[model samples]
Target chain A: MAESYRRSRWSNALFVAPYLVVFFALLVFPLFWGMWLSLNKVDLFGGGQFIGLRNYARVLSDPVFHQAVRNTVVFVAVSVPTLVGLGLFLALALNKTTRGSSFLRGLYFSSSILSVTIVTLIWRIVFIPNDGLMALIFNVLGLEPIGFLSTKGWSLFSVGVATVWWCIGLPMMLLLAALQQIPADLYEAAALDNAGKWRVLTRITLPSIKPTIMLVAVIQIVMQFQLFGQALIMTNGGPAGSSRPIVMYIYETAFIRWDVGMGAAASELLFVIILCAAMFQYWISSRKEVA
Target chain B: MADRSAFSPENLTANRTLFWIAAVLAALMLAPVLWILGLSLKNNQDLMHGTDAVFRAPYTLKNYADILVNSQVFGWFLNSLIVATGQTLGVLTLCSLAGYAFARLEFPFRRAIFIIVLFGLAVPEQAVIIARHQMFNWVGLHNTHIALMLPGMSSAFGVFLMTQFFNAIPKEIDEAAMLDNTSQFRIFWKVLLPLTLPAQATLGIFTFLLAWNDYWWPLISATKKEMYTLTIGIASTQTNFAQSEGLGFLSAQAIFASLPVVIVYIFFQRHIVTAVSGGAVK
Candidate 1:
């Protein structure tokens, strides 16, 4: 009996041992090591004395980091609503079970499957000055071409548009699934009451999928907070750093400038922001279930 | 309401209105894709003069031909394939084993470790990227496929998904296998593992897509030209931002790089959609 028990425990350890090793090495260890690195004056050459929060102070005081934060905030603010709202709109419109609906869902969702590089490449063609699709339209209208990507005013906006186009698919799919789960009987009852379409949507549809809306919103927020590639490819954080995001700032600081300590500090700040968002989601979801 | 008669006048008109709206939106969504496609077929010189030349004739496959002739593009393509497939298989094996342990086996510190894994879900890749890169660099693993594949294998999301899936299976199956004197590994491999195919498909498709599309880690870690994945390799091929000189060629590269993902999406639409929806809400 003792031998059997010991063998079973060893077998159980075998099951989880590999993942735990990777988990510690790749995830857990890196997380705390990153925190420790944030306190030091490390660079690409490695090994430096611990500076004790001076890196954080410098990163916080840097003006470029401020702009990157502002740009990231602008991105999350503008893109999250549009992604969630437009996704909900698309889901509601395509909620009906028909051949056309599924096809349209697929068409919209197809873009999300694409890599950031491909999505940005397609949008760059659309937004490039004087000869892009947008420019072609402007010419047709005899309107002067605006530098969607080059100009500071429109650069982040252009990135937002491309991001929405790329990311709207996931929210749409999630909302559509939530909409499908709303029982048909609830809709039938609302119909029997002679409820107006808007009334039904306002009363029944929105409330049923509230949790999903929150989920999608928080997901987009966390995702948009880490905006690197879109800016990297689309605007390259150009036009006086107007479109640079925090993640890009981290990349530039660490990889480009070789300030690993400051980059780690900036990234830790980003991690805090994401943690807050995740915690907010947890609070909302758990409280929602209770209520 | 679902009860509304299919042929009712009110319903038909509403449906028509919805259809037209959907059609317009679909066109808007597809316009960028189609625009790129048109540009990809046109001559680079013509595109530079005016983007409207896409509508004219004399379209050529020279752009695609150029890409095919570049030996580096093929190398990048192969690298991306190896990394994505390797990562996906590694994630499946590790997650399923750990998930089986978490869901079924009674192990010490299981609850605590699982909580730690769950906490990992909140930790963005950006947060730990520098440290992870430094670790890999220290070990002289940077610019290698192992460097590309190893970090992705430590996916908390995969472990979580697999655990939930394994948990959903009835305990009776394991008990029945135990009655047959089957080893726990045998049960997991021979009996229980087969039942999780649907979950495996969902997780596998997602893992593959993410690994394939991943950029940040690859960009920094795989710095060597020979080590470049498709994304970094293609991006490297660009000589300038908003490159007008090789517009056709750039478009072709974008299309070519995305072709495999698009093909995978076409084959696994159901699984992809399920993973997207279920992965989030759950």
Candidate 2:
């Protein structure tokens, strides 16, 4: 029996070998390398000095880093709630309907499949000044055409709007699935109790889908903090760096500025922030589970 | 108590209003896509002018012709196809093995390792891109397809999904296979993998779309024009073709770039929907 157990153990090792190799090589190795690179003054073509927290100290003093932090905070503060709230609202609306609901759900969720690049490009056109869709709409309303993408104040907001439109689909689909899982009889009971739509949703539906909602919120927060593609493709974090996200700043520092050390330092900072957020999520989720 | 009876005027009005509202919202969701299709067929002059001539604009195949003829668009398309397909296959093989192990194996430090793997899901590729470039350079794999495929082959999301699915499978099946003297690897190959089609399909579609649409890594790593993927190619076109007043052709190129994924989506939307919804559940 012990020999058979040993054989099974060997088999388990063999089964897991391929995955562990790839995982270590691709994910784990680069992560450690990033941590090490963050410490040193590394160059693009090779050769580096061991700076030892100098890069980190420089990042702390940089005004651009501060701006990136502010922008990221603003982005998360505005975008995450909007995305989850809008998604939930749409899911609720669609859940009540019986006719063509499946088709509508598919239509609503389809945009989630489009890449960030395509979404940003399409919206860049839509948000263009003077001759774009927003211009056409304002002209119809007899208002002056707003420079949505080019203006300083409107740039981040415009990007946020486009992001909200693009990202609402997945959360919407997830909420819809969760809503579907709640039994029909619960709603029927709520109706029998003379509860209004609002009450039923608050008392019955909300509590039932609390876990899913929390999961969606956590995922959205993580994703929003990593917002880079839209800023890169659409605005290039322009209009005097008003829309520059932390990730974009990291990319610019490394690639455009050729300051690999500074970029690595910034990446490490971003990594810490993301790690804290993830830990917070884990803590909250586990606490809930235990409760 | 509210009456459950039908045929009430208020109920009828509410139903009709809700239906129309939902229908309008659905149409609004599709408006951007329709607008893109409209722009693709128009001339550069028509596109800039923002005239209602979008529909009445002389429909020409010149844009499509140019994309097909003038640029290295086809080469980029082929590059994206090869990379995406290769990455999909790699992720399937690797993630499934790892996922099955995580689900079924009773190894020492199993939970600890699984937690470490979960941590990977939170590590965005963009964060470590500089280091990834450094490592690739060191290994002499920079600018190669292997550079593209390597990072994608180890997907946290794929492992997460597959593990969730694998965990749902009964353990008796593995034991039954063992009693018949089948190897563990063979059991995974012949028994578990067949049941994993839905999960595999989900990961396959997602990985394909991701690798196909990846811009940053390709933009940085693939300095050569010949090595450009679809996203990089479109971006280069938008930047380089800025002077030619060739919005129509550019839009057409964008359309062409997005077409393969769009067609695949349309054909396999049911599978995609199931997968996405299934993913949400887990």
Most DockQ-accurate candidate? 1
* Model 1: CA > 4 A from native: A1-10, B1-15, B279-282
Segments of candidate 2 deviating more than 4 angstroms: A1-8, A96-99, B1-19, B48-51, B240-244, B273-278
In model 1 chain A, which range of ten residues has the least summed lDDT? A1-10
lDDT of 2: 0.77
lDDT of 2 by residue, B184-238 (tens): 6788899999999978888888789879988788988888888888788777665
- List per-prediction Cα lDDT, in the order shown: 0.87, 0.77
lDDT of 1 at A141: 93
Count of steric clashes across candidates, in order? 0, 0
Residue-wise C-alpha lDDT for candidate 1, range B1-282, written one tens digit per residue = 354563232242235577679779999889988998988998899887877889999899999998888989989999999999999999999999999998988767778889989998888998889999999988999999989999998879889989999999998887877877888789899999999999999899998999999999999999999999998887776647565888888898888999999999999998888777655433
For each candidate, what TM-score against the reference? 0.95, 0.92
